[model samples]
Target: MRKVLESLQRGAHAGLVLDRFGPLAPTDEKNLPERKDRHLTAVLEAAGSGATRELYALAFERRRSTSDPELSRSFQRSVDGAMVIGLGIASTLEAGLRLHQTYGVPFVPGSSIKGLAAHWCHRVLGDDRGGEHREAPLWRKEGDYHRFLFGTTEACGAIVFEDAWPIPNSIAGANGGLRREVMTPHHLDWQGGKGAPTDFDSPTPVGFLSMVGRYDFRITWNGPPAESATIAGWLDRAAEIVSCALVDWGIGAKTSSGFGRMVEAETGNRANAIATVAVAPVGNRADKRSSGTPARVTLVAARPKGGFDVQEEGRALGTLTLGTSPAGLSPEIGMTVDVQVHNDDPVKPQYKWPVASKPAKSVPPSKRR
Candidate 1:
């Protein structure tokens, strides 16, 4: 990992198209001195890349699409309902060493969400048997409803918990957005070695990560043929537990030092935020999907931030996240590229296209370049 970061730094120096930069949290605790500074700087630099920004923008757009009132209605068969749960991670939140492998963005994993849910359910809900039953086999071939909902070794759960991510435009640092944080751990030798450098040991700064922002957390229900009333009740209880767990119990690393504590965003609570959308039924759902049919499009503009504006004929279409087009698309404004409409929210619509045919022999290499 260190080698990878070093290579990217070299690429940036050589004017190469460096992939996005992100704070790659260090795993070796011994080398703690420069971890914080290096991480924050790298992430800021990476986030500035047009390619990186484009990915975030597109992701945000897709998220918005899922939440759109009218558009979401189309997927009524495959989807159950969705809730926008917002959370604020305290400055001390240590998301560990993981970042989105592709985007480099920090996120709370779905596993953590599952854990948070289970913790709230068994502990807060006052399960008399306690978490001890967690290991016990549900054993029923039909599966325990609670076990089926949350999942156990015997079966997968009915719900899909997505990673909680930073909302697009929300990761910005300067204008009251994300703030870099410092973690200084004292008595490193004792802590690091489990003995040794005692009170006399020097303290070291661990890392600096962005702590600001109320991230959106989305949960989707993919189900069994349960009664609507039963499913609705379960969803209600689950959302409540998750909300309480995040606020009351907190999340991520370092809650005791005041890290990972977050409150719900003002938009709405789970009950109001919840929206039912049917998952498109199996048959002609593919026909209804935008990607099923591809259309040829022309490039209108190359966004400075690593994406291209597209048009079909003279009509404006939308933005294509960088690298979505083939190298043949070139930097020219009028180049044609085949594309498929990407499903989007009522807000911003976009499309993605296959790599263009090899650059025409008539075009100069410089033009292609």
Candidate 2:
């Protein structure tokens, strides 16, 4: 099996390799842990070749262009942290990753997206009914927005949530759309119900595949043309709900652990209200913004190599490379920092270190000789 896996040329389907060709360790082997580590490392390395990247790029392009401008509203989002989908799927390594069957790239399934939105609508948006012990039903029977948008068990919805694919070159790493992650379980015996959890328990570190990058989400209206205006309003609202859900509640496995949060990326067109819901322009000319204007940007994530992926409000401001800490402040995820914008070209704005306020000179104490 190992020889067969090695013989396969580069760019082979990563999902196939991980699921089918992964090396196994003997149960009684003394070096089982070492073998497992080696196997996971090899799998991680094999999954991120140049050929796979090209394939992902092609797939992204094709998917992005497929939705009709008139019928569909598309938006892009940058993942705020690591996202793991299909984590329960059986795998030799005990952790699973969902990848595109054809392109072998990480993607958010449309069904999953819809499910998250639906759940959010039911729990958060649904209006409260009467009873003291009661909450809002799945949806109200009369003029139910949820029913119209997501549809009932009897009928299909007016809108379709398309599968989300990553933006090309968005993931800041050599790895093709995937990141290697580790999970350490400290109380395995407690979890197995064999013993009480204690600090002295040995921690088992398990490696898994996760993703961090920009993902393009699309939702299209396919209902009656006569009702387009009404549906468009609903679609816009739906987009906002989904955006809020992605950013707040998150999606996919381990969301409670902050695994799938995403923020809206900048878009050129404001006409598509659905796409422009959460994103804010960095320094719009209409705002009388000029070069070197200080702007507050949020640190989204640290780049694998160096620097940090920063965003203004929800709009992505691109990677900020710093040879030294600005104002002697270290960059950390989710921290907001003020930066000077070099907006000579509005399309490709550059962020510079904020003009540091000079510190007050300390007064020399008079010597009492």
Candidate 3:
């Protein structure tokens, strides 16, 4: 157990066990192997399987937030595979990065998501702290819907908010991965309206903090049932309102500069890719490599003992076994290699190429100045 924690801290792909896996025994890095490396945060063997499979195992355990993907799946319609962007970084790390204890995957707590939903609900109804009064049941009286639904100092809310998890390999755009962003707090010396901006009040640049990409959300519908419509209608309306709220107001730490805004993710392409991988008997896009098709793939992580994962063109092409490459080359995270599958092996064909390679220069030789 100590060895595994040591592996996690010391840049080893021990596949950091999630909190549900069991309590992580205490360990110190002092006795572990001396390897000064900052490893890329990723998941274990089951990272990119069906979302349902992963969520069922991870949903209810040791989560800090209400963003559970498993709970969200129960609802019908477009909210499935929906995204909730950076909810904020409240962490022990100096830079304040939060991750799933087991998979090292970043996420937004379901509690925060619930807050977003409630905020959205209130905003749409024009009851956002307006100090307006109305009647019973739907309109509010003692032991009314709001109190019953959201709870009070004496009771807990009926709704069960679930922790949100990122869809594996759902990083959008070219450099789809965790990003470090800088936050600066200016005029920290002034308290209230007591002080004015001066030369002494230099801008303080907080260290670059890590933030994750878009994520999927799931919130259970154990709260109050709609007085007027079916549960489905209630959920649909709530989903629509909250989705808009996320985009308009955003969530988490820095909203003025736009930090936690999110929208539904269109995962069709990824879905197709996963399906292709499951059904394909032999041929695939990676087939071009046999014909000497050279493409750039980012190596996410490599096991100190053996294999590593390859993400080509913003998509994970599965882990490739690090066979005997020319010269003894060790694997490193964030290394790019030009590669393609050399042959059609029945069992997920392992591609052959240099452990690392450079991108072919786009400019034609004649066009180069």
Candidate 4:
């Protein structure tokens, strides 16, 4: 147990354990050279069979004014996903104006940032055109996965958040809640403000005005696979969903007009972030066939909202083998995913509570209920 945790700590500061299988030996004489090989073997044997519980968490940021319809609509329609935008009447319009001009635009309306993130999701989902229903579900009732089981080439997914910010003014108002100076682009009325002219005369405020905008996407899934093929299948679908969300904001695909970055403070690395898929197995009902290991399936975790459709049961998230083997653990296993981003933005800390431990062993399958 310490070895496994050590290996994971080498890479990430925080981590969560996903679908699990039993038969892993407690530290003891039962440990053998064959033990590692045996464990790997068990994991590989389970490919494409099915297992239990899939989850995901995705987050993004927006800058918009309080009155934008897009912000409200995005949240109202975001039954599965949530969005938050920055909006604050700059403590001083002159300060806000200086910041706006620095971004190479006449104004940095909060709505524009909000639209950028929505568009980002749209691009990720590959649905920029917005014609088809890409079937990204929060979770589906089980049997659907088996319907296309053996020959199934397509996969489904979903996205969600707890809040939606469709405009810049909204963020400005919220900012004061933190008791900081409120400043945003939209609050500046260039056509008729104190400046008389909209363009910048100097760069001081412009530099300070360049506030950092942020977006976050997190997902929990059910597998670690040996190939990118399956992961791609999931990613392609996820990208499509993000695209649709952006389109709703009137942002089009491949447009410089709609752009922003994905920040993962969890790691200092800042590149366009991609999916970080993890795996865990469900409770027993093991081994589809009497093989050295039980057949395992690979599954990615995602929110239950958004429109991506997926089945709740029998979806081959990848298989689970009771024992472990390195070779067949799936090439996709033990890999790190980095999000695409730029800028060294500071992060705010949030409150959290400590958790208690649980009993290690499972009761017999017969007594699961």
TM-scores for the candidates: 0.50, 0.64, 0.44, 0.23
What tens-digit string does per-residue lDDT give for candidate 2 at 1-369?
754654455335677767776665455778666766666565556666655777677767877778677677877888777899999988877888888787777889999999988887676555453442122342333223455567667556667998888887885366766787889999999999999999899998888888878888889885434233444554666678677678767778998887987766764222322333322222323443686776766654454466655555422234566435665587776677777765533322456676556889876688434
Q: Tell me the lDDT of model 3 at 221.
A: 55
Q: What tens digits encode model 4's per-residue C-alpha lDDT throughout 80-174?
A: 12121222333212222112221111122433433344344334433323644232221122322221211122442122222222122222222
Instruction: Give the number of the best model, judged by TM-score.
Output: 2
Runs of candidate 3 with Cα error greater than 4 angstroms are 1-9, 12-94, 128-145, 172-176, 188-196, 223-229, 267-369
Which wins on TM-score, candidate 1 or candidate 2?
2
lDDT of 1 by residue, 173-262 (tens): 442223455567788667656887656666665544444465666566644433344344445445555666666656765566666655
Candidate numbers sorted by lDDT from highest down = 2, 1, 3, 4
lDDT of 4 at 211: 24
Between the candidate structures 1 and 4, which one is better when assessed by lDDT? 1
What is the TM-score (0 to 1) of candidate 3?
0.44
Scored against the true structure, residue 369 in model 3 reaches a CA lDDT of 93
Give me the runs in candidate 2 sitting further than 4 Å from their true place: 1-11, 127-143, 267-369
Q: How many residue pairs clash per model?
A: 12, 0, 18, 100
- After best superposition, candidate 2 residue 290: deviation in angstroms? 54
By TM-score, the candidates rank as: 2, 1, 3, 4
User: Higher lDDT: candidate 3 or 4?
Assistant: 3
